[model samples]
Target: MLKNAALQYYHTVCSPNISSLLELRQSRKSNFEGREHQKYMLVKWNEISPNTILKKIESNDVELALSTLVINLRNIRMNLSPEFHAEKILYAKLLQACRTHPAWTIACSTINEEDTAALINSLRSNVATWKAQNKPTIEQFPRRDLDDSEILFIDPRYFNSNSN
Candidate 1:
């Protein structure tokens, strides 16, 4: 299971690089491009009260409430919101907590081998596609881009991004 809070931390998202000085070409069709966004609730499965969860997570006690949140998210993924990933600041805190104590994260309990593999496969393909279109040079992907060290692996972290 994945949490919305963690997704937000992914800040992995990149906005369009529209140049202010660039001239627009005349076209009958629209030039607009929409990016994807996942909306996560500020609260966690009704546990970890809004204002309080933030502080607790900062102290690393976030594992206390992360399970419920992750379960809810998994349900969302398996059922209703397959293409959406909800991310909130408070949710990020829970993610941090889960990182420190993975036994508490859904990845440890809810996520099975097949689901984990499927998710990984999807991510690899997505990364490949992104790499192809953007043509990320070796220098750009240097340690930083390829690095998973930044992510704390408590229960074996899982990141999900929803894009149309």
Candidate 2:
């Protein structure tokens, strides 16, 4: 059952269409090119609270959330709104948490079996690097759980035109 789930996630992330950004553009249509998907992302990002995002990650929808995030990041251009910036920052934190998650690590390894050992090693190295960068914040990731205590919510106010 676990293997099956991991394989499904792998296919979802690494499938031909998903693996290619061009395919993402062609199929999603609204990704990076159209405002439709961007609008959808904006609505969903706002509708879903931080706690809900954590719940989604805990429920193993990390890939979906991460994919939507990548799409949103690519979609917005020129001006970055506070909502958009908040969405990006929040999703990025969720993604980092998911990547370092124990179960997620195993699933990722299964997906990249062609380079399983290397990938796992790389993940560990990356975790160490994130730890060095984040200090105390990094300690919460290894426990393999997402909850209110562990979430890092970013303030939308932090977004500034000058920063971009």
Candidate 3:
């Protein structure tokens, strides 16, 4: 019964919002495009909707299917743009709610730890590279009033030799 509620929350709320974000990201040029593993993850995430999970449940591999979905959802959340901060926070809360449910442990156990760690490392590396490449230049920062003047901006205390 508890599992059903979690699944319902995922199907009705989490999936649609996540899918829309993923679709929007897909339509644009993405960092994921440069890496084969990321591209594979993107494709897998797009393929495994809540409806697909429902079908998988009929095959008696529900635990593995749910585990994959959760992992994919985590990856999608990690890749979401900063513009979606509110949505990301909401998803994090929702994911927390799902995780609190007892059924989550059962689903989680079906996932391979080594693969999950590798996937996480790859995603982290991708994010780090993207941040490095797209970081704001010094010129992009807002200039302070002192920056516009040629006068030295040192503190007055630095000239007080008598204090020592």
Candidate 4:
């Protein structure tokens, strides 16, 4: 009952009026603290309702500029070590960061198969979380009909009027 109530409150009350200004600020500041840091924006610019925050960026807060954003993102990616293992973005970001930093890539490559397996599992779970939080209506299935080589992005041309 408590869980249900909290979820309801999150979906309704907390979903609209309040944006995570503190989180945004913290993420921004952290990114700015390090030259190697990546850009981090909890609420995307285009997703921000028309006039609210974009205006700040446009007004030369300067901190909100695209260059600053890139910094925050890089920092976030590089600093992504999770306490819990089931976070895919952390792995993705680490992998990305490692790609740019040869030393990091060498460290990642030296890990044994067991540790690699665990990290991959955590990352896959994180991907699921991202999909669910970003697109609530999309259904996730345990098995996919498409094999690794058969994957393609959905396009209008792929649809058939009379076919299932």
Best by TM-score: 3
Better candidate by TM-score, 3 or 4 = 3
Better of 2 and 4 by lDDT: 2
- TM-scores for all predictions: 0.19, 0.22, 0.25, 0.21
Q: Can you write out model 2's per-residue Cα lDDT over 1-164, one digit (the tens) per residue?
A: 22574456446754644766676547444333356645655665444432355465675343454444444444442223445455445434344444555434543444443443444355446545544654555555476667888898778897566765
Taking the tens digit of each residue's C-alpha lDDT, what string does model 4 give over 34-150?
334322232232133212333646653322332343344444444433321344543444444333322233344544543434544443444345445555564565566878789
Q: How good is model 4 by TM-score?
A: 0.21
| Location of the lowest summed lDDT over 10 successive residues in candidate 3 | 100-109
Off by over 4 Å in 4: 1-86, 113-164
* Candidate 3 lDDT over residue span 1-164, tens digit each: 32665566556655566557576455333423335545565565456554466566665343454455556566665555444235444343333333433434333333344354443343334434545655677676777675456667778777767767
lDDT of 1 by residue, 29-85 (tens): 112111212223212333433234435456433333343444454543332233434
Worst 10 residues of 1 by lDDT: 25-34
User: In model 4, where is the ten-residue run with the lowest total lDDT?
Assistant: 42-51
Better of 1 and 2 by TM-score: 2
Ordered by lDDT, highest first, the candidates read: 3, 2, 4, 1
lDDT for 15 (candidate 4):
56
lDDT per model vs. reference: 0.37, 0.48, 0.48, 0.43
